[model samples]
Target: MPAKDKMDKTKMVTCTAPVNIAVIKYWGKRNEELILPINSSLSVTLHQDQLKTTTTVAVSRSFQDDRIWLNGKEEDIAHPRLQSCLREIRRLARKRRNDGAAGLDSTGLSHKVHICSVNNFPTAAGLASSAAGFACLVYTLAQVFGVEGELSGIARQGSGSACRSMYGGFVQWIMGNTDDGKDSLAQQVEPETHWPELQILVLVASAERKPVGSTSGMQTSVQTSCLLKHRAESVVPGRMVEMIEAVRKKDFPAFAELTMKDSNQFHATCLDTYPPIFYLNRVSQQVINLVHRYNRHYGETRVAYTFDAGPNAVIFTLRQHVSEFVHVVQHFFPPETNGGDFIKGLPVNHTALSEELKQGIGLEPMPKGVSYIISTKVGPGPCVVEDPSQHLLASDGLPKECV
Candidate 1:
């Protein structure tokens, strides 16, 4: 009998993964191939409703070869990282089949796959798009192949931060000490409900691609920056412990302070790199200043800001303070009046800015400095979509969006 006779006409799976913002950033790599980090890092997984990547993977014997489309455009399927994920998932499926695992789709193991993925937010603009993308790809592929258990290590091979995206709520990526990278994986510190009042606002300074990609920038930082070396060895280990504690205790001030400090140090290491990689722009600096000034005015840390490999500012604050803080952001970095809804995602109640608050901030208003804000909260990890209508690929094993 042909392989088609032993298998269903098509086996497909769809999944969505959320973007994660590292509070204790992951910078350099110990091993480039495995994408192992120099130090352990922690991040908050943003709600999928506000930001996410949806991916569909279909397997069929009729397909001649493997193919992929990203955001409605076909991409090179031979890309090395993509190959790593594909190879590993198939290898796992074969192993399980040989072991006589129940519910294994034996015939589909040899079939070709077609993958279609798209992000709700901007890609490569330092919004952790790769983290969500790779996580979703690995997850959707596993679902189709009936492979289960510990897949974060496989996701890490695609993108360093991708490992952390495997879990929900507050997660930590432990930089394991191993040559083969068998131990470097992500674990959740807390669930999405751990801190219900916690809120995240993404200030999109620019949606365009960053001047320096995180991969190249990190390679350079490892080569030249002594500060980066010092940070990896001495700094991050202690902060990881403290961050976990703060999360567990629900201590907002401690969490905010550690977050801001880590972000500052991460950027400092970038500057210490030879030829100095610059990710933050003038608008980013203004955001930083505004955050500190706003906190100082209240005599406490009400909000904190962190920037990853790009100019976008991700702010962490409490639900009680979100409305006012947003108003403050509007006052300092006025959006274009013609711009549709300056705030996106979760709704924010309108709060009038006080004259005293404005004077306390006392910064020159930079009109349209920030493109817009995405208001979201901590949420779950990769999830399967039960509805067949949501699949990105149709029954013929092709992207639905492709004409």
Candidate 2:
């Protein structure tokens, strides 16, 4: 091919983004199209090494039209949210060019794009996969187009929680009151380094898809649940303040308590909705009780559990408590049901559980309640993958591997 043709053939970028679990949940949306939340919320971005989505965006003149393949399955690119993200990114690029900021060739700017994204973890598990997915998508698209600066707003249009995944460490989605959502944006409260001892565990209660999707669930809650309105107005603002303070101070108990309370309230609002949506099941309830029992046995809050639109539990604790918590989890949700290790990802230090300690909590064993546990910690935000080997798409703009 000619040099110019080769140059226009494929320009690509790959990026990875980490999933985040809200400490003070963002349950209701004030604006569905803009994805503006009713109240500000905070979350700890989980380590990318354990839970994340890797995405590649390639724009080539030869490509016929915009397309996307998620987890190797072709998906409609015309999805309203996806279109929103694409429109915003292209608009930014066009604005920059018209303003004489910087510009890529017009053909490259207008060329169709092929996107491939895959999550290392199970998509059906309801692990806020969309948060990381959209963050990476917007980030990679911006990189390919050579546009930079605040992009959480663009990601927010794809998924409300996605905006927070744009930053690493501790982040907050400020619920701006402006009608246009111009002030509604995600901000970083602290870098990942601020809390070295803070650890996170994902307790996989059930990998199956959530019964109620967040979009419809929140819509129903907004229309039917008065408790949701109350929490959005009366509860979340205070929790956001305390959660930020607790994170900054690296106060485990304060953070843990706040995390648990907010999660419980989020679920409570779900219950309050007409024709209640149940995200938590027997296993989820058991995990909640076990966490409280373990903390009560120690007479202190060493662990906290948060659920995000699913039955799975995202546990937060400090490094010192990780080993014991894993042991406790293993004891209650025995791996014998699956005939394998209950723990995956970051290895836990072997600790002999005192029979007395296990007996003290006095909870009946719920074998196979949890499929497995992913041990991880707070980590950085979206990142560009420089290595060619990591790209999920080929030079021809086709997926390299299927998930």
TM-score of each: 0.98, 0.97
Over the stretch 63-115, how does candidate 2's per-residue lDDT look in tens digits?
89999999989999999999999999999888888877844555578799999
lDDT of 1 by residue, 1-403 (tens): 6854656588889999999999999999989999989999999999999999999999998899999999889999999998999999999989999999987768888889999999999999999999999999999999999889999999999999999999999999999999999999999999999999999999999999999999999999999999998998999999999999999999999999999999999999999999999999999999999999999999999999999999999999999999999888887888886335899999988898989999988999999999899999999999999999999999998888653
Instruction: Give candidate 1's whole-model lDDT.
Output: 0.94
lDDT of each: 0.94, 0.90
**lDDT leader:** 1
RMSD of each: 1.5, 1.6
Show model 2 residue runs off by greater than 4 Å: 1-3, 103-106, 337-340
